[model samples]
Each structure stands twice: as C-alpha cells, then as structure tokens.
Target: MAERRVFITGTAGFIGFHLARLLLAEGFRVHGYDGMTDYYDVRLKQRRHAMLAQSESFTATEARLEDMDTLQRTVEAFRPDIIVHLAAQAGVRYSLEQPRTYIEANIVGTFNVMECARAVPVQHLLMASTSSVYGANEEMPFRETDKADTPLTIYAASKKATEAMGHSYAHIYGLPTTLFRFFTVYGPWGRPDMALFKFTRGILEGTPIDIYNHGDMWRDFTYVDDLVRGIRLLIDAVPPLPEARGGSVPGANVPGDSLSPAAPFRIVNIGNSDRVRLLDFVDAIEAEIGRKAIRNYLPMQAGDVPATWADASLIHALTGFRPATPFREGVARFVAWYRDYYGR
Candidate 1:
C-alpha cells in the first residue's frame, strides 16, 4: 500500500498541531493549512508550524480559510486521501463581541473547505465541532444523538451550522463526513485564551485568575494527546453511506451510535468522559506550580454554560477508543512545558 496523504486545516492551532504531528510520525505525508491569525498569539502558532516543519513529510500553507482559491489550490495539489478541517475563529465570549468573524471564518470558511472537498472528493472529511453546542441542556452527559438546538453563543451556532452544512454535502455529493465534538482539551501548546493556559500564567506571575461562576463549573477536560489519539483512530472509521450498508446502519452492532440514516455522515464526541470541577482543576495547577493563585470569583459570563460532559461511547463503539487522561496528570505535563518554554 502507498503512503496516505492528509490535508489538515488549522495546523498551527492547538489540536491541529498535535494531530498533524501524530499523523506525520505515523508516516503520513501531511499538508497543513493555517491562517496564523493573531486571535491569541501568532508566535505560538509560528512555533508550532516551525516544529512540524522539522518533519520532511510535513508541508504547510499559511492562508486564511476564507481564501477559497488558496484552499482549493492547496487541496488540489496535495491530493489528500483525507482532509481534517479545524480552522475557525474560536471562543465563546469573543463570539459575543465579534459575531461576524465567526460567521466569516466558521460559516463561510467552512463552506469553502466543503467546496474544495467536493471538487476533489477525499475518502473522508473529518471536521471539529464543540461541546458548547450542547448549550442550555441539563443533561448529565451529552450524546451525539442529543438535540443540540440551543446554542448560547455565536461560536456554538457557527459550529452547528458547519455540522449542518457538512451533512448536506454528504447527502448530496456522497461525501463521507464525520463531525467530532470535542470537550475542553488541555495540555502542552494549548491556546493562551483557554482557562488552563490563563490560570497557569496568572499563577506563575502571582496575578489574579478569574474563577467564573464562582468556581462552580465542571468540564470534561481531555488531554491533548489523548484527544488526538481518538482522532487518529477515527480517521480509519469512515462512515459508510446508507446505501453502501444495504439500508442498514453501519454501527448498528453498537448501541447509541450517531450514524446518519440519510447520508454517509456521523457525529462523535471525543472527550475524557470524566467531568472535573473548576476548583479541583485549579488545585492541580497549584500543585504543579508550587504556588497558589489569587482567585477572583465572578458571576458566570454571558454565553457560558455551567457544565459540559460528553457521552463518548459512540466514538468508542466506532473506533474502539476513548480519551482517558486524568486532569491532574495532564495539568502537570502542561505546567512543566510552561516553565521550560518560558524559562521560569
């Protein structure tokens, strides 16, 4: 068999960086496309791209997802067997302030990717969604089949929109599509905007860290490597069209699978399946940093959910894997990287 080629968007972003590295290590020739926006820190994005550049099999294109021509050209030249779309203007609070950015990047940008994929027709198209789509739901653990109709923020809405668009493309064009909803992913090379990164920085600098909802929140904080491992495994678990399965569901052997009946599409949740309290997460950071943070308790901000937990059995059923990294161990690994990277 020939080596597989993968084209991954947002290769300079947190999850994308890790996924591309994992694929490259496994001998996959990868083409990475990233805008390298200054949403958080362009330097961090540059550093991630630089590290991946060390691999001879990794090639990167620096361009925005809204640039349809560039995206289409890059995908055409790469001729990837699989395409993983992860680029977006991400953040719940930021979405409230800049909803148009989310529309352009998440909506229009995703449309551009789908168009390119349609033209080239990859074997599988896997895109990233979010647990935030389960907004306003009081369910203990969100399943892929759960009705995610109440998206609190534009960020979640934009992701939901992409999922809908992906389904249509799969139904109309027979594209094999998988939309994976991720939980709170944290580890080394994490986005500075995320809670873990902000808290670690504030603790190290002896500054105040905002504990939202008075530290009452709970999250299924998945480790970055573990999250990417699930992704790597799911790459091979492509959804089959209903017709291809003789009008039977592909994963009917396993219960609670989110395989679509009308299209070759599925939605899977990639999470740790263990919810950790915000205060306990802080404790893990304090232990790793050897210092206590100045905690600033505040009301829950708008467009924020009190908790997010994922029922990852669907992903496990399909790929025979689930994210299992504990929050403490993942935090320790992230803090060690923080200290070394910043020369603390």
Candidate 2:
C-alpha cells in the first residue's frame, strides 16, 4: 500500500477528508481533487485541505469535477491504482431551489469521472451515493437489492441516475465498481447544512433549531470516522469479475449481496444501522453542550423523509466491519471539537 496511489474526489468534503487522512496514515499516496465550491463555507473546506496538505503523501487540485479536462488531466497524471469519486452537489432541500446544480455537478461530473476511470482501467472505482435514493420506499431497513424507482427530489434522482451509469460503465468496460449509499453522516468537521452542526450552533448561540416533521424524524446517524473507515476497508474488497465468479451470478456467491450479474459492480450501504430519532439527536446535542435548546417545530420540509434506516449487513459481510459508534458519545466528541474550533 505504501507505493499505491489513490485519486480521490471531494477530499475537502467531510467524509473525503477523513478517508484521505486514513489512507495517508496507512502509507498510501493520495491525490485529492475538489471544487471547493461555496455551497457551504469555503473556509471549512480550505481548512480540511490545509490539514491534509500537512501530510507529505498528500497533494490536491482545486477544480470542479464538472471540468472534464482538469479531472481527466489530474487522473492521468497521478496514475492512481484506485479512484474514489465523492464530490457532488449535496443537499436534498437545496436541490429544490438549485436543481440544475445537482444535474450539472452530480450527473455530468460523475460521467467525467467514469470516463477517466474506464480509460485508466484502475484496480477499483468507488463512488458515494446516498440514502436519499431510497426515496418513497417505506421499508424499515433499506437493503442493497431493493428497487429504488421513485425519487422525491432532484438530489435523489441524480444519485439514482449515477448508480445506473456506474453499472453500465462497469458492465461495458469490466471496471470494478462500488456505490455506497450513505445515511445521515455527522461528526466534527461536518457540513454546516447538516442537522448536528446546525443544532449544535443554535444551542450554543441560544437560537432556535428547526425540528422538521414535528420532531418525529429518524435517521441512521453515522459517525464520520466510522463511515470513512468503511470506505477504507472496501478499497481492498474490490468486486471480482464475473468470469472469476463462475459466469456472473448475482447473490450466487454471497448471501444478500447486491452484486450485478453482468458486471463487476455492487452497491453497499455505509451507515450505523441504528435508527435514531431526531428529537433524541437534538437532545444529545443539548446535553453535550450543557444548554437547553430553543426548539422550533415545523412541518416536514419538501424533499425530506420522516426517517432513514440502512441495513449495513452487506458492508460487514464484505469487509468484516460495522459502524458501532454510539450517538451520544459521537455527539460529545463533536461538541468538544466545535467548542474548540470556534471558541464557542
């Protein structure tokens, strides 16, 4: 692994930053590419990049993923053995106002990454998907084999489209591909638009935090470190080619596997597998910060779900790992970091 080179997109993003740091510590050379868009605070992204830059094995390029020329050039130059595509226009509600950004960034940008990966024939290609794609599915725990045909928001549709695109590329080019459906991920260095960050900030500043769905929401809140650890392990668990697996059989080799019968591709859910109530999450934040929150109850937001639960069995079956971080413990850690980082 010391000599291995990895090309990862969205290294400045929350999960990407943690994944890159883990790989760098394991002696893997990492090249990070991010647009550093003002979707949130550019300073947060910059600070993540700056910390990554401290590592000698880490180098980065600040460019949009939609810039095929730049993305292609960086991939070809780095000659990475693996590529993890994590950059995208993320946020469900924002997709309602700026739907085109989701189409441009998530759709076109992902296509560019696929083209580059196919051209390189890397050992593996991993990309981030979201539980949002499981839109309108009322299942308790979403499995990889579940049919996700209904997408409530443009953000969900864009991700579902990419999954199909990824499957096609994997089948047509024999590229080993893995798409991870991430649940509600939070921790220190989390995106400001996310619930945990907003709630923490609101509580500390004595502001009212919005509780959508009348605080009846539930989410599989995954810790950032745990989520990234799953990505790191999956890197080496590359899906095998069909011929190697006795002529392409989905679920033939592994029970409950979502392995495509025609391609060396599969989808895995990366989450805590523990559903947490929104009110409980908010309470955890308040408890950690040692303050009472001014709660603002609101109806469900458009493009929002009442709950999201991930069946993380496939990830464990594939890599013998599971996200086991307790929500309260993780919340405490983030609260400490938040207080320290912002001097709150």
Encode model 1's per-residue lDDT on 275-323: one tens digit a residue: 8999999999999899999999999999999999989988888878989
Steric clash pairs (candidate 2): none
Q: lDDT of model 1 at residue 261?
A: 89
* Candidate 1 Cα lDDT to native: 0.93
Q: List the residue pairs that clash in candidate 1.
A: none
Task: State the RMSD for candidate 2.
Answer: 1.7
lDDT of 2: 0.93
TM-score, one value per model: 0.98, 0.98
Off by over 4 Å in 2: 247-252
lDDT of each: 0.93, 0.93
Name the runs in model 1 displaced over 4 angstroms. 246-252
